[model samples]
Target: MIFMHIFSSLCVRTLTNRAHAIGDELAALFLLANVCLMVMPAAVRADETTGTARIELLHLWRTPGEQAALHVFRDALSDPSMAWFDTPVQGGATGVRKQLSDLLAAEAQPNIIQWIPSEELNQLFDLGVFRTVDTVDEDFADKLLPEIREVAETDGVLRVLPVGIHTYDFMAYNRQLFERLGIELPTSWESYLALGPLLAESGVPLLSVSDENWQLTAMYRTLMISEFSKEEVLSMARGEADLETYRNRFETTFEILFELRRFAAPDREDLRWEETVARVERGEALSILLGDYIVAAFDDPDKLICARSPQSSYIPWGFDSFVFTHVDDPVLLQGQTRFAKAASDIDNIVNYVMHKGGLPVISGVTPDQLDRCNADTLVAWQKRPLLWEGLLQGKNRIMAMNAVIVTIWRDETITPAQAAERVIDAMSRP
Candidate 1:
C-alpha cells in the first residue's frame, strides 16, 4: 500500500521529460505561488489573417456537454470577427497549476491551472498579466451577484471573469443502482460508511475518484469544507482556530478520508476524472464524488441522486472562469473582450453553463433553467460562500498538508493523529 512509489515514478518521468528543471520537491522548497503567466512574443499565439482576430486558449473542458458550452464561444467567434484556437496544455487548468513548479523552473508555461482563488494567482493578478472584467463591458458588475462580483473584484480589481459558478464537492450516484443494492441512500459520510458492508455485496466500489494532486486536493477539501461549519472553516483559514480547539473533528475528518479507500475503485491512480465517472455510469461503481461539470457523462441526470458532499447540510461551491492574459494587440484585445462579453451574456452563458451542468454567472437564472441536481441544490448554495478555493487565504500550504492525507491513505502506519499533526505542522509553517 506504499503508493509513494507511484508518486516517485511519476516524478521521475516528469524530471526525465523536463530534463534539468525543478521538480515538485524543489518548487515546494521555493514556495512561489505559480509560474509567472508571462508570455514571450512566441508564447502569445496570435495571428491576423484577413482581419480575423484569433486567440489561443488553455482550458479544461473536453466532454460532449463541456464541448457544447465551449461551442457557444466557438460559434460566436466564427463570424469572421474573432475566433479561438485550442492551445493544448496537458492536465487542464488544475494540472497546469500543479505543474507550475516545473513550469517556472523550465521558464515555460505549459501545464496545470485551477481557476481557484489563491495567493499565487493573486500575485500574478497584482502584476497585471490579466485584463479586468470592466474592459469587457462598462456595466459588467450589474450582471453578477454582489458577492460574486466582490470575489471577481478582489482588492478592488476586476481581473477574474467567472463564466459559471460550480461545485465539485458533491456526491452523485445512479438511483437504480442504489435501489438494487437494497439499502437506503446514505445521507451523510457517516451513513455511507455504516452501509459499507451492504454495498460490498453488490460487487462495486461505493465511490470513484482521481488520484492526481489537484484532484486529491479537491477531494480532501470537499470533505473538510463539508464536515466543518462554514464559520469554523473560515476561522481555521484565518488562523483563528487552533488545532486543540478542533482536534477531534480534524482527526475524525481525516479518518473518514482514510477510510475512503475501502469504497474507491482499486486502479483509479491514473484515471482521468472523466474515467472515474464513466465507471459510475456503467455501474462499475455506485457513485462518484465530483464536480457538477461532469453531468454530461451520465445517461440520465434525473436518475442520479446528487447532493453536496457525503455530508454538508449547506452546499460548498466555487466557479469556473475564462481568465484573460494581457496582450497589447488591438485584435487580441478585441478578441478577449468579445469572448468575455459572450461568456457573461445572459443568453450565451446560460447555454454554456447548462451544457456543462453549472449555473450561469449572469443574474436571473431560475431553477427551472437547470438540471435536477443543480436545480435542487441551488437555493441552499446561494447562501454559502465559495468552497475550498475561497478558503485558500493565499497560502499554498494546502499542498504540503495534502501530502500528509495521501500518506495516511496509502500507508496504514501513518495514523490519522499523525496526519493531523502533520497538517497542523504544515499550517504552522511559513
Candidate 2:
C-alpha cells in the first residue's frame, strides 16, 4: 500500500506540470485509485497507533537562532515519555500564509500549527476544527498573564496561547544625540513635540520611520490606547466603540505629527525599518518608533539604545503563542498538552525569548537571567489600568497622528489642522 501511494504521488507530481492529454482521464483515475488504496489505509493505521501524536508547526521567522531553538524543541519531543510527533517548517511571511492554506485543505490536518492575529483562527474555531484547551485544562488559563489570556481568548473561549510579549511601536532614540544636545529624555507628548523646532534649527532630523503599513498600524494602535481605555480599545476592536471618539483623539495627535514632520529627512518615505534603524545608529536621525525586535538588528550593544515608546505605557506587553488545534484522539490531546507545558517551561521560555530579545510571558525567570540581556533598553510594559489610560488619554494617539501628519507636513500637503483632520479621517475608517 505504501509503495502504491509513493508511485501515485510521483505520477501526480509529474502530471501537475503537464497539460491535459489523451491519457489524462486514465491518469486521473489511476491517481484517485492510488490515493484511496494508499492514503486511506495509512491514515487508518495512524489512528490505530494511538501512542504518538503528530503535529506540524509553521513559523514566520526563520533566523538561524530560531531554527536552533526549534531543533531543541524537536529533541525534547523525542523523549520516550513524551509520546509526541512533531515537524517544524520555517518560511518567509508569504510562505507561511500559503502553507496555512494548504494545511486547512489537508485530509488530516495537523494537531498544532502557528497562529497569527487574524480572522482565520476565529474561522477555524467556528468550524470546530480546534479543540478548546481552556475547557480541558483550567490550570493553563491560570498560568497565563491576564492580558495574555485576554488576547488568547476569543468570545469567552481560548483560541491561542501567548508565548511572549513585545511592544513593536515603542520609540527609540540615540543616547549620544540626546547627550550631545544637552536635552533631557522627553517623557510627555508636550516635551517630545517641543523638539521639532530645535531639531530644525540644528539641521538634524528628529524622527525616522518605515514605509510599511503594518508599522503604521502598530503605531496607530499604540496611539489609540492614549485616547481610549483598555476596555475601550477592546471595544473598538469588537466594533462597539464610537468612531468619533477615536477620531477626536486622532485629530490632536495629527497636530503633533505635523510639527514633527518638519525635522524628518528628505528621503524618509523610501526608508524601511532597517534603514531607519541604521540612521538612528549612525546619528542621522535622533529617534524612531520601532518594535522591540529591533534588538535583533544590532550586533553591538554599544552602538544602539532603546526605550519603550512613552505610548506603550498604554498597553500590556505580550507575545504570540502556539495553540493546539482540536483533535479527536484523547492520547494525542494529552501529548499536545504536555508539549504545551514543556514549551512554556521557564528555562526554555526564558532562553528562547531572551535570545530573540523580547520579554517572556511566563514568570519564572531569575533577576540574574534578565540581567544577562545584551541590550539595556527600558521595557515600558506595565499593568492594565495605567496601560489603558495611556492609550485612551491622548498620549499615544498622537504618535499615529504624527506619522501621517508628519508625512504631510514634510510634503507640504496641508497645514497642521488639515493634517490632523486627515488623521481623524484615517482612524475613523473601518
Candidate 3:
C-alpha cells in the first residue's frame, strides 16, 4: 500500500525531483514496488469502444524539428482512411511524470506514453504500467537498430519502439575557435585535464555544462564509465562492487570532475543546456560536454566538431521510444497499432533524423544527407557501446552517484577520496 501511494504520488509536480537529487528513499521504494509487481502480469481490457477512440501521447521533447516530426505522426495517426482511430500529441516537460501517473490510474487511459528503454523504465513495464507492442507489427522489429533491439524487449516481450539512437555523453567543440587558439583537441583523459588551466589562462572556458541534476548525472556517468572498465561500472551498478573495491577508479573519476570545475564557465550554475551550448557556438567557450542533441542547435556541420568523450572507449547513449497501454477498447487498441506503424515508417524515421540530428534507429535511414558533423557522429556511434546494459540500465545508481559528485563540485572542502566514500555510501543504503 505504501508502494502504491508512492507510485500514485510520482506524477505530483510539486514533489518531482526536477532540480535536486531523486531521493534515495523514493528510488528504493520504487525498487521494492517493482519487485512485487514482477509476479503479476499487466492487465489488458478487451472491451469494445462504442464511440470514436481518442488517445493522447505525452512527451518532453521541445524543439522545432521535434515538433515538426511529431506533427507528422499526428497527421498519420489521424488519417480517416486508417479505420483505427484518431490521436493527438501533447507536449510538456514540467509535470509530465505527474500527468503520466494520473493517466495510468484510470480504467480508460491514454493509449501510449513516451518511453526510454532503460532499466528504470523496464521496472515500470514489470509493474504492468505498459503493454507490449511486439505483436503490433513484425516488420517494425526488423527495422530497429541491432544495438537497441534486445534492450527494447523484456522477457521476450517488446514494449517500446525506438525512434532514434542518441549519445548523451560526448564532447562537441568549436572548430573555428580551436583553430584560432592553435590548440588541438586532447585525446587522453590526462591531456584533457591538462587543458583546463591553459584554457582558463586564455580566458576561454574549456567546457560548458549545466547545473541541472540530470545533466550533472550524465557528466558524472560519462566520467565513471571512462575511468573504470565496462565490467567495473556494470558490477558497481549490480551492488556487487563498491568504492572500497575500486577506490582508485572512483577517486580518479571525482578528481577529474573537480579539475574541470576549474575551467567551467562562470555562468554554468545558471545556464540551461541550450544556453551552455550557445557559449560554444558563439566562441565564448571552446568546447562543451553534452548530449548529441546539441548538434540540433548548429546551423552548419563544420561549425562544430564531435568526438568520443576523451579517454573513453564507450560512449553513454540513449534512444527515444514509446510504451503502449493495454486498454480493452477495440478502437483504442486499433489506434495503438496505427501509431506504431506511423512511428516505424521509414519516411518518418528519416525525417526525424534530418530534423532531430540523431541516428535514426530504423535500418536504411542513413545519415548521408546530414551535415558533416552529424554524419561523423553517426559513423562514430558504431564504435561505442550503449550504456543500458548492467548497472547503467537504471537511473537510480547513476543519479545517486551524480548527486554526490555535484556536491563535491560545489564545495571545495570535499576531497575526491571523500566524494568517493559519499557516493558509495549513498548507493549502498537500503
Clashing pairs in 1: 93-113, 94-113, 95-112, 96-111, 96-112, 96-113, 97-112, 97-113, 168-291
Clashes of 1: 9
Top lDDT hit? 3
Q: Give the TM-scores of the predictions, in the order they appear.
A: 0.81, 0.65, 0.79
Q: Write the per-residue lDDT of candidate 2 for residues 1-430, one digit (tens) a residue.
A: 6887676566444433331232223333323333433333222324444355544455755544445545555565675545444444543333454454444333344666655443344544554545655533456566666756655776666677656556554666777888888887777667876887787787778887654554544554555455556666655544566656655565665555555555665576645555666787788878886666555554443555565555444543435567675455665566667667566565666666655566666543444565332223222343334332222222333334444633554456676456556765655554
Lowest summed lDDT window (length 10), candidate 3: 11-20
Best by TM-score: 1
Q: How do the candidates rank by TM-score, highest first?
A: 1, 3, 2
Assess candidate 3 and give its TM-score to the true structure: 0.79
Sorting all predicted structures by lDDT, with the top scorer first, yields: 3, 1, 2
Q: Runs in model 3 with CA error above 4 Å?
A: 1-55, 75-95, 105-108, 120-123, 134-136, 154-157, 299-302, 328-331, 364-370, 389-399
List the lowest-lDDT window of 10 residues for candidate 1: 33-42
Q: Give the Cα error of residue 430 in candidate 3, in Å.
A: 3.4
Once fitted onto the true fold, the runs of candidate 1 whose alpha carbons sit more than 4 angstroms away are 1-47, 97-115, 119-122, 154-157, 383-388, 393-397
Candidate 1, 1-430: lDDT as tens digits: 2555454445445544553344333333223322222222224333444454655556666666677777887787678665566643467654444444444333333211225554455556655434465556767767786657766776566667777777766778877787876767676788887766667876778778777665676688777765677777667766677757777777887888777876777887767777887788787888787677768666567778876676664555667776775556566666666766766667777777767776777677788887677786676567656554565544445555666665556666777787777788877676
Shift of residue 323 alpha carbon in model 1, Å: 2.4
Q: Distance from true position, residue 10, model 3, in Å?
A: 17
